[model samples]
Target chain A: MKRYFQNKSLLNLVFTFLGGVLLLFIIAPLAGMYLNTSFNSVHNAVGSEEVQASVWLSLWTSMAGTILFSFFAIPLAYLLARKNFPFKSLVNGIVDIPIIIPHSAAGIAVLGIITRDSFLGRAGELFGIKFVGNPAGIILAMAFVSIPFLINAARDGFAAVPERLEKIALTLDASPTRVFFTISLPLAWRSILSGFILMWARGMSEFGAVIIIAYNPKTAPVLIFERFTSYGLKYSVPVAVVFVTVCLIIFVTLRLIKKKN
Target chain B: MLVVDNISLKAGNFELKNINFRVDKGDYFVILGISGVGKSLLLESIAGLTKISSGEIILRGRKISDEKIQRRNISIVYQDADLFPHLTVFENIAYPLHSRKEKNIKEKVLTAAEQTGIADKLERIPETLSGGEYQRVALARSLASGNDIFLLDEPLSSLDSKSKNELRVLLRKLNRNGITIIHVTHDYEEAVSLANKIGIMEKGEIVHVASPEEIFKHPKSEFVAQFIGIKNFLRGELKALRESDLKEFSIDGIKIFSLTDAGDGEAFLLIQPDEISISNSVESGSARNHFKGKITDIARAKIGIEVTVDIGCELISLISIDAMNSLELKIGKEVWINFKASSCKIYN
Candidate 1:
């Protein structure tokens, strides 16, 4: 037993040392950017209406996108977890396609579906809504790429719940919908909630897809990129720092809620 | 009455083909089979959790194969209990009633909890309960639904022996109260102890359905014969004696007499262990089959001591503890085992 403990500690030390390098590597860039930016610049950036609008847009649109897509995505995830049919694996692979392909390509795919000449674009035009250079397009782009995270995580969550529970619920005179809402959904809430957070966070940080579909909407990430390329590190660092702070605050708050649940 | 008429289901590589069975009202029907033979699949299909490829399920003359699970009015209990982890025992029991929009959910939950002997534990969650208690909560939930028919899928297999026995008694009590039950299990003794009728399943197909006595006494196939190899089971040839109904049964060169009409060919003979009596001193009594053999082994049984006597070929006798003690039976003790000719069963 002592020998095993000694060996385990040695292996643990090696693991900690090796894994710590990547951890430090992640910390270095963010710490360097944060430390280089002045609090006065950050405060000034927060005061700017463009910064405020962009930040608010990023947060709310991402949340809206996460919530709206969840209704359909969650059911799809549950179906993936429970039932078996022909091309089921193909369907699963299609869900993951958004995650693996380039974000810009996903943006192009979204643009194709919602372009002004397309059916949804013309349909939205009748309702005084435009896809190009619009928040709706931004949400579509964000949701397109980030939905895989929600779907995969929720699918795993639903899978982790015992199938027998649903079977028993059905036998207990609960309809399929009732079993899903009462038994499956609650049991898989943790994973689904975490997936919600991840999807929202991933949507908030989106740049490539959002830029392609709606560059004028000026999400925080787009503004950061524009400022960085046009001005330099000094002008963009403050915005970057503020955006990171807001993301972290929301991420940590959601994490805490998940923990409590 | 519930009838599964020629139902067939294809689930991946396993298939339940041409499955047909029926359970009368107020009867405890058990499907006895080994694991991975589609026993649970059969129950799931019956519960409408899976779609059947062919045939129909009839419940009281109503075709229910097309009905939804919520409308089927049959409840089921699983082996692992599968209680909602977040809900208390009371809430778990009340959940089904709530879904059905039943009036007096609290009263029904309390009644079901009382029936399963979990009235006090209603406030507790399933995670805090033992295996037996967890299963009781599941059973209580089913009872709370007020369903007359129940499908239990190895509900006692996951429990300890004590819990298994307790659940068996509870099941019997529920059946006596006019509830029809179709239970699945791999344990032969459990089926015999609880089932008024038994269906033997093999490789996703039901091989035979009969009463427990008939199943044990007249196993139809080699698989069942091996699966339920009761004590003192032997395969041999039968020879007609000059006497009226007596036949000479020879098992591996050892001769025994039994009343049979298996005609004179090869046959199987079974002597129920409980039917044999053992004693230290030989008494010439009414029992036609008697042998003086040394007690080779004496072992504990579920209800008594199982003694194996090497009477040429070995023969097992089940005797009570008092009988074992009074007879002073032990290893290497000389004893006489006696059983009536009617006690022996012979079949081809």
Candidate 2:
């Protein structure tokens, strides 16, 4: 067994086998789909009204959700990291609720609040802003399920900042608020940015909640689902492939930026 | 002047009670204590880092109990070299000055860096600096802010002996320049060497507070005597008592005298390690009490060598290196160990 294992020939054979298997997992499906796909079909998919609207809606809603979630999550994360409060564990548990619940159930739960009968919908009606089938509902759905990643990640980031640094800042005559901005936030920013990127990617990929509340606006995920249902695999696969590749590029770039940070 | 009047704080498992002391303008008050004795907590309480349960911290004639830490004008240098890693060495030292938006911040930072000998590492980040350099930057950052009342919590703890001595000298210089320093450390020698007033803390309370001379010469309690490493403590009854301001006593047929004016009751004799002497013969000298004992052990200490001579009933005397050599001392050698009555303290 030692002689067999020590054989360099056997090691090369193992590498060849493993590399082929890995390449099959990563590259085979994309190659198979693209081989089957035609330039004319790609053009048609790109030109379609529903596909274009779906792509635009996905962009706007995810961007808006990411921005809003980051704005709210950063401070709350800092608070959870740095301060002592009553019912802290309870607050932490509550913050983790969205991440724990199934995405479909999370979507359903959000749908329950934004539907016409709910309090938020009632409040929105007073302001002449509807939620159901609206872009706002799509954004609300994306933000609801995806925000926990940002919050939790940002919390870890903020928690990593040594409290001594903050106290030192305070001793330096920086006010508490000033200290947070100058010392705490900057120190915790790498984690916060990673959280932000995770949230953005999660928001962009949101399907269940958007389908539940704003299926009419048709984010890319719902559109892909609808196209698959109506026109079978042949018609839908190319669009799905295009949508995924675009998102993959974006998500990877975001991750790289997070890594750099 | 910084006056901590009866500060008592109970945080988690650690309790600090009745911590009363004062540091006048330009005074370097070093608090010495063991781990978990609330030395850092006390410093924090004074700095407004930890909230005081009940106390008045009057700094520079201002009662800053409820005041925010930023407004208190008390800077702290923690043990961990708590420099902001994101900020460069210059930026870290410049932090306080920048926060106040003070004019001449760059000049102040440069000056501080120069003083701490970290001027060349200004542009370099904190993580790049060595432990000694990091602490020097921390100290520079602390001092550059213009807060004369500096709360240094083991600033030299991270540094080696050489660095510690250099920083100690720098701290002494700082004090001489009218910076009132409250330096907290677990090192007894540092407190003895650097502090104008040393507060010996045990179990959160300052058990003894005195000048270095007074504390070393006459520690009031057993804990202090033990803490300060005074090795000549023995349980004894005052056999015969002298009623003068400086009294006398005896133990176990070995007559001894103490400066403490205690009655003929239970007393513990206290003597510094340096005060005990060993002689080959009964030499007539300034020392009052002489006891015949066998040399038990010899060990080298920082200041001098300690000679432990066993006087049958477990009485020990710690003598100097010169004294040890002068007597040509070795283990199991019978000798006359003389520790004067005036030198020994009887604490009741």
Find the candidate with the highest TM-score and give its number: 1
lDDT, model 2, position A149: 91
The docking quality of candidate 1, as DockQ, is 0.54
- List the TM-score for candidate 2's chain B: 0.70
TM-score of 2: 0.76
User: Highest lDDT: which candidate?
Assistant: 1
lDDT of 1 by residue, A150-217 (tens): 99999999999998788778878788888999999999999999899999999989999999998887
Off by over 4 Å in 1: A1-14, A108-115, B10-13, B217-226, B231-348
Model 2 spans with C-alpha error above 4 angstroms: A1-53, A100-130, B230-348
Report the lDDT of model 2 for residue B47: 83
Q: What tens digits encode model 2's per-residue C-alpha lDDT throughout B271-321?
A: 765677677888687777787888788777666776677785545555566
